[model samples]
Target: MAEHNLGDSHQVFDGEGKTFTINDKHVAIFNINGDLFAFEDACKHMGGSLGKGKLEGNLVACPNHGWQYDVTNGKCVTENECESGCRVDTFPVKTENNEIILSLPE
Candidate 1:
């Protein structure tokens, strides 16, 4: 695992998501009530960009198909009944010196 600095935490406003690339991997970082969460940028349903989605509390609605996912855990909330094993990849996030840091798998 490697930590990548994602700029200042304030760059991502509350209830918003931002996209970043670390080690050639695209990641979506979300800010919820001053907390940071990281996940894959692409939606599992149709390859939609989750970073461009709308954030509602801890859930982010996919822009392409309206699929909602929990930003904190990357759980597919829109298709919980389908049990399709469709889930976005989640990564660890932290803040140091007001900078958002994301852990990416090496």
Candidate 2:
């Protein structure tokens, strides 16, 4: 696994999300309450940018197709069988010295 220092925690406000490209990998980072969650930026159904999606509690709905995913675990919660098996990759995230840290698979 590899770790990256994304940036200041303030970059993501409570109940908001942001996108960061590291090593040519697009990552979506969300801040819910005071905790951080990271996942692949692209949605599985149509490659919509999850980073720019709408956040409702811990779920983010893709703006393109309305596919929602649980930000806490990357599970598809779109309420349909067509997307029952769809899921995005999630990464470990934390904060240190006020900087957001993210871990990706090596």
Instruction: Give Cα-based local distance difference scores for all models.
Output: 0.87, 0.92
Give the distance in Å from residue 20's predicted Cα in candidate 2 to where it truly belongs: 0.4
Clashes of 2: 0
* Segments of candidate 1 deviating more than 4 angstroms: 80-84
Which candidate leads the pack in TM-score?
Answer: 2
Q: How many residue pairs clash in each candidate at the backbone level? A: 0, 0
Error of 1 at 98 (Å): 0.7
Kindly give the stretch of ten consecutive residues in candidate 1 with the minimal lDDT sum: 78-87
lDDT of 1 by residue, 2-106 (tens): 888888888998888899877778888888888888999988778788999999889999899898889988889885542566689999999999988888888
